[model samples]
Target: TEDVEKIKPEFVRSFQFENKLMPSTWIVIRIDGCHFHRFSEVHEFEKPNDKQALNLMNSCAVAVLEEIQDIIFTYGVSDEYSFVLKKDSQFYQRRASEIVSVTVSFFSSMYVMKWKEFFPQKELKYPPSFDGRVVCYPSSKILLDYLAWRQVDCHINNQYNTCFWMLVKKKGKSKSEAQHYLKGTQAQEKNELLIKEFGIDYNELEIMFRQGSLAFWQKEDKNMPHESKGSVQNSHKKVIVEHCDIIKPNFWEAHPSILD
Candidate 1:
């Protein structure tokens, strides 16, 4: 029993490495606002009235986790849920658009059944759309920190939209530069540059950007000020950026291939 306990974590790690190939990038799946408006009519009856809603939401989360078992290694839940995927896994190679498509379809089917079961008589009002962003990164630490930040944002904002961000390192660039590049600067020009350099269609790239998501920035604009006119007002913006790096993939290394 002691041996089993000691080896369990190691075994899990080994399995992940063997299957995922030491992930060169981080793949994040984030779900926001999974539960809302379970029971509105019975405001006085709290326990039994709300139980169904809680159960339905839990079931939906389970369904989502089960569906993505092949790709996700570890996950966490709150108002939002985040799943971290192994790098170099077949899942990472898939087009970002495909990832969102599959996720939406699965949620749609699961939610339909769950809603019907929970609210059979009254017309069910679906919660806000489960739109989310997907991001990939090269550093596990960065990805984990980003996930923590996302959860905090969701809790504070009371909004339903979710964002996924990934960090992928350029083959020969220093990690610091890669991190800066991933932060997304001059996104419009970057998008155009990527299209020109890679010969990928601009429209398709836009779709990938939609699925892959964007970065969040807290900005203090010179044009915008606080009501008092003495303090600076800061605005948060979510913007998507994509571009290639100066670093070239090693000829002998198996790097992630961009898919259409």
Candidate 2:
């Protein structure tokens, strides 16, 4: 029994590679679908924007936020999502592999579990998987910039896809023709095409399509009956979800606690 208690500690220590994220920093774990183009096609996702698929993704993200207390915020577009851990978090000792792997695995599982809820009529041909990576930001400014970059990318891609699908679905152009027509066209040109050809104003498009989805916690008070009749109990904090424009200064100002 004494020898069993004195077993070598190196046996466990050897398994770790010391891939720890820096302390006093923000940790971002981003997960993206692998070969999702084919997956989306197989699932018969609507062209340009699939509301059901996007909703499914957002639901999965909500599950992640509810499960992982350290993740203070999340931003997701298309088949990718970025989860931001609180700057002072010590989850899994800030081990990069452990945190990234577990978060992505949980997200993937939630996606599968909720798929039927999102798409009851459609059958899933195969399972889906996401690849994940971890990045650390030393300051709030850098993290803000990183999030802004993803929002900008969302805007650009949504604009292009909106035009591409318009040309294909409504205009009766083939996929290749739409691609060729969009080639070498600037954002201004795409906007003009949408306006002239499809009578669509790019700015008027849904914010969720142009700006992506932002998930964060909001504290609210819910009144409950106390032990005594007609007496109110104390309020507590609850995490709620929101989909809005995070690129604006107002959003950052409103949720100042997220970065802290």
Candidate 3:
């Protein structure tokens, strides 16, 4: 009890500081179920032991980490094998969409492959193939609150739920402004009233961002004397937009393939 008391204050302080620093940090959380069918198919193949379960969990975490690394350049893993991106700067619409799509596809593929490799003869089946849903919000506090709620739901429902959430922010907006825009009464109402409001076709944005457009450039002389001839130089900085994640009820339902 004494130790808990000592830690509580520190934890609160840390959270407060984080909220202040990145008030508008938006998180995208993807929750996936792993090897449900395989587990049932190979129920008798491996003994139900804590050590074995832990080993399997560790392996799954490693696989997820590897896949995430392959997709996103800037990301970190939490202790729970969940992925997080803090203060992410790459907010180009294309980049954001690519990150989400690649992550879902990669995780789904690797999860299936890993299960097959582990239980070669189990003949496991996957539910309708659905990618994990992405939840976006403007504040970490709200994100954590939503995660906690989902955790409770999973516990009560006895469902296999694995989540990968990313924190994102718009490039130009101040953290407070972003948070205000996301959390304001009108915005919240809009989000609540609209079904599938967060759903977006990121692939289209990805292709558009990749296509470069023309821009004007000035010429400068290099090889010739300063007065002789002029040379031209062209440069472009990728355009990126900043945005955050918000919580949506029944995110798993959005991706019926994985959930089913």
Candidate 4:
């Protein structure tokens, strides 16, 4: 018994590691799909934007919020999602690895489980996986800016992909040809090209595709009947999804509780 105890401490000391997130800050755990481009091609996913695929991602996000109460918000696109834990959250003792692992594992499992719900006709070809990382923002403004950056990235990528796909799918150009055609094209040029060649109004495109999806709590009903004091605790949150501009002040003004 003495030898076993001495050996355990000597071995565990070399391998034990824990990186706690900074206190009084917002924690963002982002997960992106691994090799999803090849996976999407293999599955014949609709190009530029796949409604069902995005829907599946959103569903997994909703499930994450329902399961992880500390996570107050999530922003998700095609193959990636970011979970934002509250500023004062002590989830998993603020350990980065635990938080990242829990969220990523649950999200990946939910994605696999809900695949059939979104794609009933198509069988899942193979197991899909996600990679995750954790970062902490020192202030709310910085955190919001991080989200805005992601939204802007979504807009840029969607615009490029829309043009690329239009050229390839509609004009019958090869992938390389499409890339060459769209090369050196600015946002205005791309918009004009879409309008003139494809009769597509970029502004009228789906908001989710342009802005990605943002999910957050919608304030639980405090007036609801409860059997006892213990039952008054938040049984569940009212999580809502929006596909609108979070880059501007309008969204934050409308939902101040999201930051509160």
Which candidate number maximizes lDDT?
Answer: 4
Output the TM-score of candidate 2. Answer: 0.91
lDDT of 2 by residue, 1-260 (tens): 99899888999689868898999899999999999999999999997889899989999998899999999999999999999999889999999999999999999999999999999999999999999999999988899899999999999999999999998889899999999999999999999999999899999987778888878776656677667676665666555656677767888998777776
What ranking of all candidate models by TM-score puts the best one first? Answer: 4, 2, 1, 3
Candidate-wise lDDT, in order: 0.44, 0.90, 0.36, 0.92
By lDDT rank, best first, the candidates go 4, 2, 1, 3
> In lDDT terms, how accurate is model 2?
0.90
| Candidate 3 Cα errors over 4 Å, as ranges | 1-24, 33-58, 69-83, 89-96, 125-128, 159-260
Per-residue C-alpha lDDT of model 3 across residues 16-58, encoded as one tens digit per residue: 4221223234535353445534544344432112223323333
lDDT of model 1, residue 141: 56
Q: Tens digit of lDDT per residue, candidate 4, span 82-192? A: 999999999999999889999999999999999999999998999999999999999989998999999999999999999999999999999999999999999999999
* Candidate 1 residue runs with Cα over 4 Å from true position: 1-23, 33-55, 73-79, 118-123, 126-128, 154-260
Clashing pairs in 2: none
Using alpha carbons, what is the TM-score of model 3? 0.36
